[model samples]
Target: MLPQAAQLLNKIIKLDFQPDIVTYGAIFKGLCRIGDNASALTLLTKMHSAAHCKPNLVIYNTIIDSLCKDSLLQQAMDLFSAIKTDGIQPDVVTYNTLIRGFYNSGCREEAKGVLTEMLKSNITPDVTTFSILVDMFCKDGNVKEAQATLQLMTRKGVTPNIFTYNALLDGYCLRGQMEDAEKLLDIMTQNGCEPNVVMALLEDMEDKGIRPDIVTYNILMDSLCEAGQLEDAAKFFSDLVLKGLQPSLKTYNILVKGFCKKGLMNEADDVLRKMEKDGCLSEDIFLVMTFPRHYTTAIL
Candidate 1:
């Protein structure tokens, strides 16, 4: 597909066929996946004007997804407005994509408004939609709202996906509600939706009948760190090494920040040394290491 995407575009242009909606949808998705939104939108506009290729819900969703990939949230919103003005009623996908975009931009308030709009239009929120909202609430540190949205979805018979569970669990863990987090983790497995920070980690671990990945450790590591349980975080990092899973930059950053927060300069230095030794230090983590602060720094 990589070697041929440009070739396909060339063919479309040579034919002057104005790329039908199907062609537009295909190219738009490919462009978005590759983070090429400008060309995708241009093709979208061309498709919209073509009498032979009237845009539908899918085409609209495709464009929105492209805008989102480029982090163009406001542009996506404007496009949605244009979609409405074009007499095309936004469907579930339209609202869902914008909900996700709003969340991505840390605009949870806007996301909430979108949710309200969704309900007003009677477009039933699906599991994926709920999952995004749950993630947004958790990341925003609005655990109460996260829990409420979770319960709301449950009562509406929209079961939470694995992402939903992970987001909720993360919220509880951040707030030092380990017991509650564990309960939800158990229920998630009972419901047969496995957690995957990234899909490869799951399939890789499953193949060896072992569970040693950066994300699993990070979940516990983040929770423990937030709880001021550095012993647990340090131990978890070591356990990951023993299991032959190298710590990702995220894992290293978590430990470094955890130690710094505790004013344990010695421990922080040791962890930073380990990160350098393991080649796990990222630019962002390296920046934090350079700016290590004492406990009193927080008062300023």
Candidate 2:
């Protein structure tokens, strides 16, 4: 659709109308969207050579982001240098694109090197830079490194947000290190960061006038179920309805499975009946509850 728009724009331009850099940039963006960076680069060249049109920061940034996403880091770097030579300084977005690309390529040091370059170039590392590093490190199972990066961000005067804390929390949880996860939660509370799980963070959210959503309720319910606290799960499930949030099918299934796991067949049947009454029952739930022994113990 965008390419066709570009063709129409060209037709309009030929009818005694002139298209400016923004107009050409839009077309360049459309070309890049179709995974035609080669053509986008060619268009950039033509724009640069044209007497009336020249590429701007947005155009350069778009191409650089596209190149990095495509794993053409060398090409992206070359374009980065070219953009700098054209008197357009690379912004944080440019560095971020390169950092993500290098990290994805397993070039950890190279990825960090971008941060160093940013500091040397007098560019401040924003929350996004720290968040990206923390997320990447956590995903790579380097939770300790992620924690260290979080500390670094704090020391550098960049307050850790909920996402930053959540990444570390998820890392600790993934490793089954609940002790560390709880400690991190304490730190988050101390730092006045909040997420919605009906725990301490729930109070924080309410104090800030932010109501807990369905996803928040689901997380709390699932956590309670996993911890063998079916009563707490049930209470939270009721609170979810009281809060005017619709429970998803997964929410019902979690509660039913929790009851079934504890051999409370009657309660499980009750929940199943409630699900049917809500018009949310599906065949999937029947299968999930039918073969409990196989479902619980079967290995992929």
Candidate 3:
């Protein structure tokens, strides 16, 4: 469809229709969506040569995002420079994309450099910008730096969202600093940010022969179910059973809630039946069944 659209666009142009920037922008987006950055870049070059319709910041940002996703970091950087040469100021989105691209490509220092440049340009870092920094620092096992970044974020009057806290939590969990993780979790709750189950932390615990208790399993299952990963959540239940651990009522409720949220009434029924078969049925399950469908979905 995109190829056909592109051909049609060329025909319209040949007829002297003079396609505006919006038309060209749509085409560029389509090309990039299909991971055909080559074609997008070619079209961008053509747009550069055209006198009437010069590419705007949005178009440049789109291509820059596409290039970054493809790990064409050098090309992305070159285009960043081009944005300035074209008298277009890079926005927060532009800096964020480049920072993420450089970090993803193992160029941590370069990513920091991009942030510095952004600050120098007086583009105040937003929550997303700080979140990325926190995630990057945490992933590097530099919890100290991640903590510092969090402090700086607060000083800058930016509130740390779930992603920010989750990164730090995972960092502490990875290093087996449960005390600090718990402290952070407390802070998250106080700040109205619920801590999420970090699967990587679970995997690391397993690798270290550290057994997680029922509560930990419940947290993980709840997280998975919330993410609509019903199958995975069910597998975790099975693992809980195989480990001679009892599935609490909350476990069944989580799965039922997940299935209900996805509109899979039959699957939800099967779970309820299984709960009964295991002699785990309780009034809570009845309450869950009695609740209106929308009510069940909302509680999760």
Candidate 4:
């Protein structure tokens, strides 16, 4: 695509059609897409030499984003500093892109430093900004920090969305803080985040009028199984059907494993049959077959 674009640009130049920054930017973007940031930088230098096309903020931001995506953080930061040196003001996209790059590269401190710089510049952090922070903290198992970030987001008048709430919920769930996770569900409702949960948690769900999606049910079922509550997990499986939700392949696998854990060969076989009837293939067939046939026949 880059070669074809370059050929067309040369033809256009021969016809005396002057290519502007936007025209050059389009081709530079294609080079970045192919993971050729080095070539893209060379093109930028060419644009500098060619008087007809001057690099603009969009051009710089595109290269910066591409550099960050390629995990060249020092190069990205160098370009970021150069942007200011060149007298083009950095915008929210520039800051957000760098912050994301740092977070993805596990450079959390640098990412937060970028956020602080953005704040000092009086650039209000957007939902995407807070979402990234929340996700990063949660993934790092810093639930307390994630919760603090969530509070900061609300205090700054940035309403949390489903993704934001979900991140916090996931953080709580990861730490086995079911009580906190349940409370977050209410906060999610109060904040007008869309509903997207567990048993007794299901009772809490009913009490709170929260609807359980398939993911919610799956999480609860998995948690229950992990807690060795196979009976409760089975109930969630039944409730899922009664609620008109189809059990996912994951749902079947969880149930099979839960029953197998309890040496309930009959129940495991039943679920395997149900999974097959549902047109789902069980990846745990070896576990299923490994269970002694004599044990299954005895249970039958």
Kindly report which residue stretches of model 4 are placed more than 4 angstroms away from their true locations once superposed.
10-16, 196-300
- The parts of candidate 2 lying over 4 Å away from their true place are 8-17, 189-234, 237-300
Error of 2 at 168 (Å): 1.5
- The C-alpha local distance difference test score for the whole of candidate 2 amounts to 0.76
Candidate 3 clash figure, as a count: 0
TM-score of each prediction = 0.59, 0.61, 0.68, 0.63
Clashes of 2: 0
True-vs-predicted CA distance for residue 99, candidate 2, Å: 0.6
Please write out the lDDT profile of model 1 over residues 1-300, one tens digit for every residue. 832875676576678756655665676778777877777677667666666667777877887877876679988998899888889889888898888887787787888899899999889999999888888878878988989999999999997766787678667766766566655654554465433332333334346454434656676576667667788678767877887887888788788778777778789789888888877777666665676663326522
lDDT of 3 at 275: 88
Residue ranges of candidate 1 with Cα displaced over 4 Å:
1-19, 189-300
Better of 1 and 4 by TM-score: 4
lDDT of each: 0.73, 0.76, 0.83, 0.79
* Predicted candidate 3 versus true structure: per-residue lDDT over 105-197, tens digit per residue: 899999999999999999999888998999998899899999999999999899988678767877787788776765664455456443243
What lDDT is reached at residue 108 by model 4? 93
Return the candidate ranking by lDDT, descending.
Answer: 3, 4, 2, 1
Model 4 Cα shift for residue 173 (angstroms): 1.4
Q: How would the candidate models be sorted by TM-score, starting from the highest?
A: 3, 4, 2, 1
